[model samples]
Target: MQKDIYVVGLMVDERSTKAPDVQQVITRYGSNILCRNGIPSPSRERGIITLTMEAAPNEYEKMEQELKNLHGVTVDCIHFSQQESFQVCQK
Candidate 1:
């Protein structure tokens, strides 16, 4: 059975935020990062990044923690969509 989950992408500074550090955190919790986009900001303080991935059932907490642990980085928005399951209805 396939379960639905909310995938939360994050954007943060690269220099300020340690890449290996963040990767380690995510790896600790077992998260598959689909894609990561790095965008340069006006100030080097922190850059914007976008992550695309899928989460398991009720695994948002894990993803949240992984990203939140990083410095100067926070979850922008989490878009969740419902996934339908297959079942037979009886009369």
Candidate 2:
């Protein structure tokens, strides 16, 4: 089966009020996360966070829903498949 790559973008208007909650939710699904990047405004009032991940459709939707449920936070995601089967390769 093919696996899709999902990129989730999060924007928080109230950083101090919402960032910790967002982080906690992200941490809850850490195993599905491939990478995470966050940028905070100089004044710390707002911020943007990006997460790159590979997970089952249900898992991805669960994460998205959790983030969306947070107050003062906006979430968006893009997912695509490269026509390649997903596999785990160990070194």
- Report residue 60 deviation for candidate 1 (angstroms): 2.7
For all candidates in order, the CA lDDT equals: 0.55, 0.81
lDDT of 2 by residue, 3-87 (tens): 4788888899889788889999999989989999999877878899999988777787788888888988888777765665443
Q: Residue 6: error of model 1 in Å? A: 4.6
TM-score of each model, in listed order: 0.56, 0.82
lDDT of 1 by residue, 1-91 (tens): 3334444445566545566676666666555556567676656756565655555644655567667876866665454445553222111
Clashes of 1: 1
* Model 2 residue 14 distance off true place after TM-score fit, in angstroms: 0.4
lDDT of 2: 0.81
Stretches of candidate 2 off by over 4 Å are 82-91
Q: Pick the candidate with the highest lDDT.
A: 2
